[model samples]
Target: MPSPPSRVVAVVVTFNRLDQLKVTVARLLDAARTEGLQRVVVIDNASTDGTAAWLDAQTAAQAADGPLVVHRRATNGGGAAGFETGMRLSAEWFDPDWMLVMDDDARPAPGAITAFHASDRTGAMAWAAAVYFPAGGICDMNRPTLNPFWHRGMVTRTLLGMLRGRGRDGFHLTQHDYDARAYRAVDSGSFVGLFVSRAAIETVGYPDGSLFIYGDDVLYSLAMRQAGGQILFDPAIRFEHDFTTMTDADQRFKPLWKTYYHYRNLLLVYRLASGPWFALVLPLMVAKWTLKVRFHSGERGQYLALLGRAIWHGLIRRTQVDHAQVLEWAEPK
Candidate 1:
């Protein structure tokens, strides 16, 4: 008697990116059989750009017999909410052994899923793929990182990097690590190409959907680690992220509303990452973000105001701010 095949269900959270969603879905479906993918669930976040219709058509084409599963939301709930819904539904409906989560603009590279299924994934509760841009460069946003607060050397390097204005390069996986053939342990990683085991989900539960966007993945991954779940970064498993490149020199947030989520959720992430050192770490993090306001000269006043509010709300763990209010604040007065 042989062991059962590992069941994998992919969860993609999409909003208004119909073109990218189409490409991602097609790739997932094409490799489903070969990679032991049990199902592909697309959580449509009330996209108005014919995304709903397209998903309906795909479902019809499959006659509800294929591996495709569509969960259409009645409202635009951002990526965090979309992922929460997709993961819960996937576990309830398909009961897969693992749930692979990624954004609309991301998908596994050719043979990547096959490699994942073939790898010896023992002991790790979650695994992150080596995500790269379409041009083959590493996607900095998707890089896996160790928790600096958990390691003495990492904390020292992080402090030195911050003082030198180099950012936190100490905890992040190096280019050499990506090129290596061995897997590395990571404390946290982005949602793109992250595979979460059912056991981990059962222990830590779903991601914090209230986060609404930025930092949700980091928070969830850190929570997984805090719950004693090990996360591994396997370079052999690869993903392609078709997203716009934003350099560190350009620290301004477009649409402005995203700034609130970025800063607010960042506070929560820092608290989780630092634990007992949060009191000391919070001020340093705030100062770092404040220094970046110099780059937002076009909307410096509004940017600073938003940052203040974000900091206040984050301190109180408040997440009920309406999106409409955020949009109004972003509007030019």
Candidate 2:
């Protein structure tokens, strides 16, 4: 008797970036047709732009050749909720052997998914792609790092590196060398091009939907690590990220609301990852936010207010907030 076919599903969370969505989905569908990809699950976060309609048309047009499972949310619960929904529904709908998660702005290079499957044969529970900017530079934020807290030698070396000011990623907890060989072990990775096994998801469960955006991937990857799962970063699995968001140290408050979510979710991530050690991080976080507010010229009062709210909710473990309320808080009075 022949063995059952291996199943792979790509789960994408998209907001209003319709052009990028179109390009990504097209590439994904092309890959699915040729590269043995089984299906794709797109979670649309109630985009005002015509993202939902475009996805609908794609679903209809490509139903036969390249299968797609698109779920349109009623409200914009942000990327965290979208991933939660997409992953859960992908499991229910396809029960895939592997699920590849990415954002709409992320486009997998040729053979990226293939590289993941090839690396998975080495007994990893999850694998992350080597994400790069569209201009071919490494995407700084998506670099996978080893959890020093999980390894004693790593902890000591990390501390020594920090003391020496060796590199920008002194702690060795947030960034990795992009040139690492295939299947380097890691603790976590971003959603940009992460592949998780069915067994791992079954063991650790879905990501917390309430996170509403930032740090969701970190929290989920840490949870997987805590569950005793192995995560590998496959440099051969390359993906390009069209990240146009602010990357500089401007610290201005134009996109003030996202700052709230970023810090709030970061605090929650630290609390969950460190447990009681979070007490050591809380004061540092407070000092950093305070400094940003003091130095930034844009809307200091509003930034302070948002920072306070973020700290309060993060401390209380309240990750979910209504989208409308967040908008109201973000809007200029």
Candidate 3:
């Protein structure tokens, strides 16, 4: 007999934030109930705190009803690795057709998954990309333009720009074309929360985890659209997320050297995902970091110096997704 259809697979990747993880888990379970979901996967990125222990107890208690599976990575895989791991395992191992990706801190409003799936079944759309921050966050994830060789072509363009030693600065971002209406096509993906389809996964592959951070989600969504998948931004779902909490955006857990990954990864994405004549934001960002560092970081020109060095590195170094090795900022190993 043919195999049964794949159910909704909710995958959450967590780090040291046990409190946020617990709340996210609770909300996901609630989502399961509301949507009759039966598959759930929680990948703990090796939290040194009580998160792993609590999950162990939950499993032992058998209180995690409705198809719950938890796996603990040996190390923190950062955001991209965590997302890739959870998705790969869920679809490959568990055989779920639909995967709902949630960040450690993202909590969807009631019926968010249900609403997304409802739109998918409409037969007009293929996939649904969920919210990010700034607005309610649970707004929409849209698809980008189509060209057979676009993604790879842009990658070539980036290499050429670097080889020619030209100045281009600005991360890749497409202007919003559609009116802010209920159903519209978009060119961005809110990685914080996204509802992806199995077909999309089969088409786009997984997010690249290298260069450390940023742009994996948007690239994946774009790839899906290129492969004939539709990404919906149903306004029904809502969530909350900020760049950081009481901590300043400029004041991160890591030193300047390692944080350079953001610069590299974003440049990589802009090069791979943007149209011809990609504009690099390195100049503006360098200036911004210079100010933020000169004033906010307390050391004159420390972070600004780091930013300048980062641009040099990004222009030359090549990186790709490495799911096995991850370093979480919250806890040192």
Clashing pairs in 2: none
Q: Candidate 1: where are CA atoms >4 Å away?
A: none
Query: Looking at candidate 3, what is the lDDT of residue 207?
Result: 74
lDDT of 3 by residue, 255-293 (tens): 434445565565655555544544544454455445555
List runs of model 2 lying over 4 Å from the truth: 1-5, 63-65, 119-122, 153-168, 171-176, 249-254
lDDT of model 1 at position 257: 81
lDDT on C-alpha atoms for all candidate structures: 0.89, 0.80, 0.59
Query: Sorted by lDDT, highest first, which candidate order results?
Result: 1, 2, 3
Top lDDT prediction, candidate number: 1
Name the better of 1 and 3 by TM-score: 1
Backbone clash count, each prediction separately:
0, 0, 7
Deviation (Å) of 32 in candidate 2: 0.4
Q: Write the per-residue lDDT of candidate 1 for residues 1-333, one digit (tens) a residue.
A: 857767899999999999999999999998886777889999999999999999999889985479999989888888999999999999999888899999999999989889988866758999999999999999988999999989877888988887887656878898998999998999998999999999988899999888788898999999889889999999999999997634566877776788888999999988889999999999988998898789887788788888998999999999877788888877666
Task: Give each model a TM-score.
Answer: 0.97, 0.90, 0.72
lDDT of 2 by residue, 1-333 (tens): 855446789999999999999989888888787777888788999999999888888877864655777899998899999999999999998899888999999989988766655532438778888899999988877877666656666546755664564432643323345675635778889998888889878899999898887898988899888888988877778999988765656745446788788888888877876676567757865885687776556577778788898999988988758867877787666
